[model samples]
Target: MQRSEMPSINTQERLLAWALVLVCVALLFAQAPHGGDFYWSDSPRHALNGVFVMDLAKAMPFDDPAGYAYRYYAQYPALTILFYPPLFYAISAPFYAVLGVSHETALLVVALHYLALGLGCWRLARFWLPAAPSLAFAALVLWLPEVAFWGRQVMLEVPAFAFLVWSTVAVVAYLRGAPPRWLYLGAALLVLGMYTKISVAYMGVVYAALIAQRDGWAMLRNRHHWWVAALALVGLLPLAVLTLKFGQANLQSVTGVADAVASRTSWQGWVWYLQQIPSQAGWPLTALGLAGAVMAAWRRMPGLGFWWLGFGVGYLFFSSIDLKEARHSVFLLPSVTFFAVLLLHTLVPPRVGHGAVAALALLVLATAGLTVWTRPVFYVQGYARAAAEVARLAPRDSTVMFSGYRDGSFVFNMRALEGRRDLHVMRADKLLLGVAVRRELGVEQKGLTEGEIADALNANGVHYVVMQPGFWADLEAMQRFERVMSSDQFEEVARISTPANHKAHETELVIYRNKGAVTPRRRGIDIELKIINRRISAD
Candidate 1:
């Protein structure tokens, strides 16, 4: 290459990098106007963990953080942070403290992951193709309806996916014998990915197998591998402790769900994800990815080969589990993207005119634009307003009980109070219903009786009641609770109406003020913790 050509090549690389930046930034702005309320049930729960971490940080209690954590859980039963890993919360705490916790803060944290993922996609794709082609592929990956689906909400998939992408990039660099730090970096990212979501642990197997296949088993004897393994063990220590204490619910959920799903499906169970690929990913890319996979394995493109291995193992592993979801197959997107880009890059010969290559790039960018611009988006409202009204009416440190499908939204909004951290938020679904993770809800045990519920509410010093008809219209719990709230013991203070849209179901919430309440008694938080524990561990 002539010296004159070098400037143009560098300029093209910089332009492509900036293009990827602009594309990812556009996605960040896409989620900004939701008023910090969530649609998905789990999204708010994930966001709450961040709030919990920041609250704990501010408290900086000299005594026992573990005790603080327990009392906090007793206060907010919607919190299942114990069931999942803590890495996301750790990442989110600084953002919460700095910007204040809201849906926006959570989405911003997810946006960082999205932007990092776009970077990883660019770096990984650029390894195999030219700058313009790489940029196109990364943009498409970000635009995949599936990626954007989880991307907008504060879920673990995009965050875990981000870690997987960067980890793969580092591992690929290490595979080419770039540097030792790349190896450790890959290991750290893999561990981080697992901590972000346990589903990514299979990726560790993907890494090991790729390395061993590349360098032979003698690579196992390398001291660097041993050192990284030791570091990984230390990194996983917190998970080990959490698993011992709170993992029963997760384990039961997986196995019990697997058993249930296995009974319902036939031969389609194995091929369910493959069938949905065309919809989740576009049909054109799906066909290209298949062809690309065949060509790459036939020609033996090493990095593409690594992703090929990933797609195979990820698909088989997730499919073999009795439960199935389209999101579970998200890891396959990289392999699909790799293959599709490789095919296009292969089609366009290197000697082709720059104008022709530029046209290909424009086509991909246009497709990405269509994906982002045309996709429909909706978010829930009313929770933030309801939370504000409750916070304003209830006294500080008073317990506010909520009963609804999206108690997570309610709890998350309540926790947003920077100074009113003392307010104890309770979920009626968790306390009155005692719905264990493994048991089918509304089928097993009946909820607390009205008299029992009244005594329990008064005994706990309940001052505010936020109830919605989250159950069947005739559900004894909903009916009995309504009867109790409507009685002279309580007065309807507010009727907050929430309109249904997307994941946010429509319902009328009646917030009641306890009129006959006295300076009632308070139960030990530990006793509440024990009751909560039974909901998790029992099948």
Candidate 2:
């Protein structure tokens, strides 16, 4: 505690902190070259949202979402629509301001935003741990295969996760009894997080509860802090209105999403989640997290305790839903990261703190290096190329269908080709996909037969069917078509030959000619005439 020792202590801490931060920055920048994975529906959708926002800012571009497709423009969740448009648009502003909205330039700008967000996570981690330890933790969370898997690729996660960490840091600082300014800052970050993604709203409550548990809930009754809470609510009002107004358009549709997610009560859902845990967190990390959760609860650390609860609920929701996806659980990543770091921090003895820090830093470096080595960034580029190819091969006004929502590949392709004037695209129904399978397999499924596919194709004016056969080949249509467009589902259909990797069979891409306008099979009178005609023909 002598003045002489104080300087050395300060110097050592400063040296360690800067060293870790530099490592974190290096890892993020290394992965920067391989931008987003656009093949997935959500990734490009988000990229385009940023693109469109900037496009409008340029000179009020008329390419509205409504004119694109029903679901394309349709209201679903307010997370990406209202919040990201403005958030990422602002992020993209400098790039667009300089680059002038060219597709390549715009995407490069978005990529920079990803880099900035990654660095922000690194900075936040430093506040919780010493610079070296924090950077190591940031690297682990940022470079996790799933983090790169979900993070850089777009979706509400990256921005949402960034704000989640920001708010958490604020709350922790406040709990550590920092100045009121820190609490206000936490409130502001929480507001932005909620605006970007609503699930984080629950996080604010959890954080507030943690604070109350620490300083006593009686403090919450004070008047001065009311403004902090008020400002948070005020910032979120625009998104709240958007959700309400959009949901009002079709009450059933809005409820259906939540209902659909809730309806998947199968035991298989649980099993699927259990199966995913090892791949996502890695067994070692998951075990560490569980230990961390138990230790926090045992010590009655409410911040960590409440976080554990939120993480558990979030993961359960992730597993049970019909829409089970890695992206849905993106909000939970911060909690997982926090607990993992907390466990390491708590379990390791202070005498060997330097060793623990070094070990963690090494682990992060190894994992991030592996992730970059194996990560899939080509998916997005593939999609962008496929969209361009589709614009070329098929005739003008050729109606194209992508069998599944393979990363909204078709949607982005269509969007990229806005001025074509000759092309239209629609998603093929699952039943039609089944029909393709039945035809190819020569297996009779009750509704999805060859006749159904013929009818559906005709009805939609589908002149060309563009698909990554390997991904959706199991569908009867892909089996029936026997035309391989892009060989791998993960690979782009354009400019690349399908790899030798065959499904049980190969589904080929076919351009079926539409001989005539498709007429709907009307009910009642039409059914009666069809029945009579069949009888007359038999007689």
Candidate 3:
């Protein structure tokens, strides 16, 4: 009411705003360098896309691997892949354009992912909270051990989340009688997400549901919405071009694969759902998010509530139908945290906004700081150290195999070997076979026994076997394959292991030289990596 008081109020608000921006920038920069590294990041696939785009940029020759827009390169949405390549490549283009391919450039791209995700989180928080609370919430999401850590990886999770949050703000604004940018941007981002991962197709379901609520059956009565949908479809054109040029499978085949998997494990859906809530939910975070979502539902904030419910149900259902992996839960995390923060702010009044902001900011900074400093010691540094030793010590022609190659293929593909091709690398099929067990039995499966493993090894012509201490719960079980290496394992040929990987089934990678009779030599090594889709397993 008073002139001097007004100035004070404005200054306070300005400080809050500046503080929020500063927090976001600081958190993002903390994850800027090696912080993005994950054991089995989907980075290789993202990096491959960057490579493809670079091919496009340099006017290098190219080919369409698949003709179907959504079915190419593993049934991913063509548009999603097309969308991120340019974004990712731009960050790495200068270095790669000069030095060719290097992880250094990938580090830069992942850092950009941090920045993008941070911006998106900031935008989304603004829609729900006051300036200080909103920014603090964004920082909280950014520094989440999972979020900050994986956000920097060469993966689509952060990018997909970034787009989702940006579009959410846009769409919610429009629904509140604002403008069309939200709807358009949201749709574009949704399409982008789909290309990044087929999991994003769930967003379409969310949108359709939202529109139906807003306009009733009348929503479908208007062709304008359909036109918008068509535009989104058109946005997928470049991906379509890529698919066609590459000779990829059509969308029908892609969905067929999904359908088959769903049909096989339709029964264990609920059990899988229960299992994920504990591990993937981030302990207290999931509990907090769920509690918050309930409050939102009770408070008539159904839009946000529905978003969480839909994500949780959709992700759980999808996980059940296929195989469940930690990474699959990535998209559901933001929604979980979003609702959690919503609930937290609601429970705590703004009377203590300054204190609350400080506490939350301190938590995030502390977690991020710990991760940044210790990540190399436990995660990246360990892997790098192990990989370096393996490269240096393992015979050049010795086939390198990951004892527990769950999702660890990315590390195997990129890190296990240096720039030389003399090393023969092979991943054990026993671990990968878990993917197939769910499809056939309608329940989660474990790795194979010794006899089954022997058959698998013989069939695949595995020359070197890697195992950790935990990999053999019963050492007597695997007596068939003589252990060539042990705790001594060739004098720390850097038994490459990751920190996040539990000691259970954690093989120290005993390089058994396959003393059993070998299969006849062929003209070329026929290496078939076992594939286990929930509905099917390729032997």
Candidate 4:
């Protein structure tokens, strides 16, 4: 308890914190996402968002980003840029420009966020738990299945939640009397998190409640809370306006689209996330986490307001949303780890000392680490090669029509072309079909008849017909288009094969050469945002 002893302990803690960070780096290098790491349907879209930014910067159209973005989307129809927030892309753009657009380059950004997740969680845990338990719990949480799975992929959730964690930690530190300036730091991080993904905005309610309760009328009367309002106007107001335009589907997922799939009133929305914890995080951590949550709430622990309120409010907020996915609940991991470490510290007999807890945690981490040390799955990357072939053989400024569930992947791969940026990719489903796939199928009348499809194809100067058999086979229009591709108008020139995608139908990408004359033309894009709850009448 001596003041002099505090320096040595603080130094040791600092060393341990950085040491844990170094371990994170080692983990990234040792088990980097390989073998279709970016093959998940949404993975490539995340990568391409950054590519769009990188490509835009190269064109130097700072004054005309909207025009540039439309051109970029015209070239590749599968970008989810504005649908998601712009921070992740904005941050990754420079790296993409420096490293060049590849999955490896995109994944490097994920690795950086992964390190932040570890260090941020550890820092947050230090506020609630002792040094040993804090470091151990921080490392232990990352070993959770969902955390590791998300952090490994080029996805927005990990980075988004990491920023939220840092923000939460900073706000709690300020509440604990760290300094008034922590408010600014916390506000800045929260804005980054919100700009990374709008979902992070939900937890703002929790932070607001804490600040209101803590500061009372004096917070407003004294201007202690002005930073958050200032940040919201500057950072969030514009994002909110832009998202209204580009992220309409994303916004609807909270209510109409969300309820259509899993009603907000349904137990499925409320329980699905909790059900995932046992499997997503092992049973041991689940039990410990539950116990710690109870303990923290009962004791009214130091950081209980932030951690427990986050858990309770986060659970209700996410569960009430009509759109439900396990990833949406990843923000709850910090609370889970906090409570687990709380009980872990409690169970550690003082006689045995905290060092024993540290050793035990390391032991558990070492064993659990073995399980995630090697990421499995062989290469499922034929889409990139198909893109190369399309860029190489297709006439300059021509269109390539791709029909498959992974149109985003192909669009992403095509964006990497060196000299053929003029070539455009049109998704067959969007071009020829006006059907709803989310919640339930609402098949409108035929999207396009055989003759209409052919006319559209010719009008758009589609010189290459690439498709995976069985894709949209149920649709009458695709069937009609299939007949068109099968007829004498197009000949099967090359079969670009790739690994079967997601264990679905054999995805040997069949590329057909159109016998008709190649006409280069510009045309308006037909964008079918998926969360449209209404049916589209056949044209």
> Counting only residues 3 or more apart in sequence or on different chains, how many pairs clash (N, Cα, C under 3 Å) in candidate 1?
1
Task: Return whichever of 3 and 4 wins on TM-score.
Answer: 4
Per residue, candidate 1 scores C-alpha lDDT tens digits across 257-306 of 63444422457777787887776667677787788778877886654557
Using alpha carbons, what is the TM-score of model 1?
A: 0.88
Error at 113, model 4, angstroms: 1.3
**Residue pairs in clash, model 4:** 258-322, 258-323
Clashes of each: 1, 14, 20, 2
TM-score of each: 0.88, 0.65, 0.62, 0.88
Task: Tell me the spans in candidate 4 whose CA falls farther than 4 Å from its real position.
Answer: 1-12, 25-37, 62-64, 258-261, 297-303, 350-379, 435-447, 500-502, 522-539
The candidate with the higher lDDT, 2 or 4, is 4
Candidate 4 lDDT score relative to the true structure: 0.73
lDDT measured at residue 460 in model 2 versus the true structure, 0 to 100: 50
Q: Please provide, for model 4 over 296-322, each residue's C-alpha lDDT reduced to its tens digit, 9 standing for 90 to 100.
A: 668765536777678789888888888
Residue 479 alpha-carbon offset, candidate 2, angstroms: 10
Query: In angstroms, how far off is 534's CA in candidate 4?
Result: 14
Worst 10 residues of 4 by lDDT: 1-10
Instruction: Give the 10-residue window scoring lowest on summed lDDT in candidate 3.
Output: 1-10
